[model samples]
Each structure stands twice: as structure tokens, then as C-alpha cells.
Target: MPLPDPWNRDSLVWRIPLAGGAAESDDNPGVDPPEAWVRALAAVALDLRCLRYGREVNVGRLVWDLAVDSEYFVSIGWQGARGVGGFSRGEGLTVDASFGEAAVWVADTVQSELAGYDFVQWPSRGRHLLLPRLLATNPAWVDPHGGRR
Candidate 1:
């Protein structure tokens, strides 16, 4: 049998931009989000056991990037001690957490956010192991010519 689609209708992935709006756009340019919001997001990343990475620019600004495995990542541009941030997934989902309202909303929905991340990343984590089993069980997945169908 064919493997089931990894993404389903019930998946809680956030495809739309969050409250603050699209992270990057011609109208918005690239405005740094509030420092509080970036800090909050970093805290959430830690809570979720994600890895945090950052760099300092020559101008004294800081840029932070956080990721969950190789699946999802968010980059925040910081100016001095105050900045705002945005999150994006490899699948092209983006959320702008620049405004106060957006920041508050993100904090309030932490549980759901975690669930969403887990749901999306679950299949990816198992794909390597699962694919071999699937191919072994279902020969139709293989081509007689020695390549995948």
C-alpha cells in the first residue's frame, strides 16, 4: 500500500501570518520586533527544548535564530536591547510576532503551538525508519529497475 500523506487536513500547522503580519514585505521592509517579544519567543523555544543560535553584527545589533531539529526556524533581528521577531517553517509558513498583541497571543497559545510543532515534525522524525519498513512490506513502492517508483 502507498504511504499515507504526511500532512493531513487536521494538522494544526500555522500557514497564515500571525497577528503582527507578514514578517517581510515591501511595505514593511525588515523592522525589528520588540525586545520583549523576541525574549518571549526565545523562552518558548527553550521550553520546547529547541536549539537557540545567535550572532552579533558589527553595528552592535544581535540576530537570534532558533530551530526545532531541521524542520522549523525563526529569526529575530535585534537593535540594542529592544526588538521584535518572526517565526517561519521550512514549509514556508511564517508568523510575525512584532506587535504587542501578537506577542501576547503567542504566549497565550503556547500549548497549542507546541502541539502544532510536534504534529508537523512527527512524520519527519520517523520517515527514515518508516520508509524502509514500508518498502519492505509493500513491494509496489519499489521499481523492478532498482529505483523507487
Candidate 2:
């Protein structure tokens, strides 16, 4: 299994691993990455549909369902696409915070998870002050990324 510490981006840019894949090996016990990817793709389709048209985006099991060994833990009764879900396997980091605080910390955590994120730029780039950024800038309709923004 991949080591867990690599996912934490406390300081610099982060990278979500788009690793190649696992071949059909006798040693492999679980679902292959390709299959997992396909399943994830399908899941995204459902989420998008529900997110747009459904009455609610009620996620019952964040860690077990949406977040796969998601590795993020924060205190919240409700979570949309935003905010931390549950703990990832490696270094279990527990944070008790409001939405804004979690937003700040989670940005670092997920920015670490993204494919190419500059964490070093954080100290200077106002990432440390992201909680307000999340609350202030979050549009009811548009998401953070420019696609929605």
C-alpha cells in the first residue's frame, strides 16, 4: 500500500496521485485501480445529477461512501462537495473547527492532494487566511474553481 504521509501538504504544492494502474496480478487482492477508476467515474455522474436536480445532497457516509480512505477529519453534521469528510488511513489528523476553520486547514490538506498545488506559496499567497476566503467567496451557485466561479 502507498504510504499515507505523502498526502499531507502542510507547506507546499500538492499532487493528487494519478498513478498508472495495477495489472491483473495473482497477488492483487482488491479491485484494480482501473476498475476503481471506472466506478469512481460512474459515481461522479450520479453525484453530479443529484447535486444539480435532487432536493438534497445528503451524503450519509462521507468516509465510507464518497471519500475513499479520504484522510480528512473535521467536525460537521453536514458536508457538501466542500469540507473535510473523515480520516485517511496514514497519519490521522483530527481537527475540531467550524466550517471556516476547516476550510482553511482542509484547503492545505486537499491542496496537498491535488495534482499540482504550491504549498510554499501558502504563507505568502494568503492561503493561511483561507477560511474567510471560503466563506466570503463561496457563491451559492458557483464553486471555487473558475468553471463554477
Considering every candidate listed, which one attains the maximal TM-score?
1
Per-residue error for 107 in candidate 1, Å, reads 4.1
Report, for every candidate in turn, its global Cα lDDT versus the true structure: 0.29, 0.29
- Tens digit per residue, CA lDDT, model 2, 45-110: 232232222123222333221122234332111122333333332233333233343334443443
Native-referenced Cα lDDT, model 2: 0.29
Flag regions of model 1 displaced more than 4 Å. 1-27, 50-107, 115-149
The estimated TM-scores of all candidates read: 0.24, 0.22
> Which stretches in model 2 have alpha-carbon errors above 4 Å?
1-95, 116-149
lDDT of 2 at 61: 30
